[model samples]
Target: MAAEANADAVLAELEALSARLTEVEAYLHIEEARGRVTELEEASAAPGFWDDAEAARAYMAELAQVKGDVGLVDRAHERLSDARAALELADEMGQDGAEFIAEAAAAAEELTRAIDEMELSSWFTGEFDHGSAILSIKPGQGGLEAQDWTFMLFKMYMKYFARRGWKVTVNDCPAAEVIGIDRATITVEGKDAFGMLRAEAGVHRLVRISPTDAKKRRQTTFAGVEVIPVLPDDIEIEVAPDDIRVDVYHASGPGGQGVNTTDSAVRVTHIPTGIVVTCQNERSQIQNKAACMQILKARLYELELEKRAETLDEIRGPKTEIGFGNQIRSYVLYPYQMVKDLRSGVETSNVDSVLEDGDLDPFIIGYHRWATEQAE
Candidate 1:
């Protein structure tokens, strides 16, 4: 009787998982993804398809994604079937059903994890969700404390990217006088980098004992994080020469010595919007100008997204403000250690692990689900 009861429980759990898998399949439009995979496969096999290197690479990447999306459901079904078979075989040997029940439980847990990941992927429906991201962190209030906070954020993100197996390139980092960084820009490249990091935008508040203060008082500091998607090569953003000012100067190092002999540093200002972008990391003037233009385009794209969000807000209601004075997350390290996300109500007392060890998935997942719910 005991063996039978365990088997029944395992079967019931497997049944529920099957139902959830069905829902996931429907939500993911598995049939549509399969069709896309077929189309991409046919295109990839066509003659001269590889002639256009960029287009060929994009097609192959899309094909892989579609196949993987479809495979998730397929694999889950296979696991369910295997679990059922194992349970049936164990039932024949009634005395040893517990071992098989354990296997079934493990399989069920795996399926649940896969389903959760699929659900998260479903929330990435934004236009530029799958692209690389350009992220910037700037100090706000609290003087040098804010600068130190900004640098901490920069390191946290770098660690987070490393954990994700993403590549990060520091585009620009200017150190502060006493400690930490004044401003930093980084490029994170990986699958769905922009989609995940976009949730990290806005102000981040930090409350901690000031190391720079003599009295050892708790200080509240603010740092702004901006994440923008790197536009694909196929998308063209037009910026007229008449509407921009271009400045060229020699690139300088930390000690104010000229890093390059020529005037390689380029600063481009969008006259109408008064947005300024500079690129001095590259060696040649042409390269710096190109990099500056790319950053400018990304900024413009972000502005357009904001405008669209505002229009949508007019229809729905007022949403959280995007810029200064609107902090999304707060890290407290003074009396108590806690990291909390204001919008998602997700908080964890493991502040040190979050800041030092780069445990950010919980907050990211919470915010993603919250945003998805709001969108729906």
Candidate 2:
């Protein structure tokens, strides 16, 4: 039955897909990534490559990503070769080769999906859109409930990252005043992490019976989510020493045994913008300071983009621009359990699936499609 599923037509479609894959590889810079992988590998093998541990880690991460990009194209080419061989084998085996034809058809269909996803990359036109992302969530006006909301948002994103098979590091997630976290800082590393997560920027409002509230009354809380690309080494943003204040303190949260004992955590305050960034994830004060500066630069870069953008929404992304009046999405767990995106009008009645299970892809994709249409 599988062999009768137009194996010749499927093979022909796969042949056409081979040409499409080549074009996709060129657009995605697969050859350039292959070269970069070779260069980075040689650099990593050199002596003293790990002298500055943080920079070395960054380089190695880039190396891994470059190799992955190159390997994807390589694997696609291999699949095409395998499909061709299968088709030939099926022809040679006559009626006994149904399984080979079925397998070839399946490979073609899978490769088609992969190529379409890669082609969608063209929608991300921003300079740093393809890079890794820094995720930050800060509580708004909901007080204790807002703090709790902040923690919940952090967990939701963590779950989403896990589902996407992305590597994540908790840069900072200190305990809040009474209930939740002060804020959440996470570094997410994956293919197009910045591009995909930028949809989550801005304000998220949650309405529910506050677990922290004694009255158990319905409460409305807001938390602002910030997403910015992890800048490449070439894109340098300078920070003048005179324009910032540095504070060092004992590292807090779950950073291992001696983390809290030493005053290793570094916090930098950009005096002009009043933007504050903290890094206690690293034990060494210098390393923490470096991480703090990197975060500061990303924030400043975002600020610069905000300056250039005619409308704040263009830079902030498809969501609302981080304010009480401008909540991007609402998660209602009260009288009715519904999660909805205010901008895209994508809504779902099952709040549990969204909040607990991290089923956020529909909303994200919906907004991006809307945004792309608007651009057109």
Task: Give the best candidate by TM-score.
Answer: 1
- The estimated TM-scores of all candidates read 0.80, 0.72
In order, the Cα lDDT scores of the candidates are 0.82, 0.83
Q: What is the C-alpha RMSD of each candidate to the true structure, in Å?
A: 4.4, 5.7
Q: For model 2, state the Cα shift of residue 127 in Å.
A: 0.6
Clashing pairs in 2: none
Q: Candidate 1's error at 319, in angstroms? A: 11
lDDT string for model 2 (98-183, tens) is 88888898889878866655665656888777889999999888887888899888888888999889999778888875777889
C-alpha displacement of 136 in model 2, angstroms?
Answer: 1.1
Lowest lDDT 10-residue stretch of candidate 2 = 251-260
Cα distance off (Å), candidate 1, residue 333: 1.4
- Per residue, candidate 1 scores C-alpha lDDT tens digits across 252-347 of 643244567888878899999999887777888888778878889987876776687753221112334433567889999989999999999999
TM-score, candidate number 2: 0.72
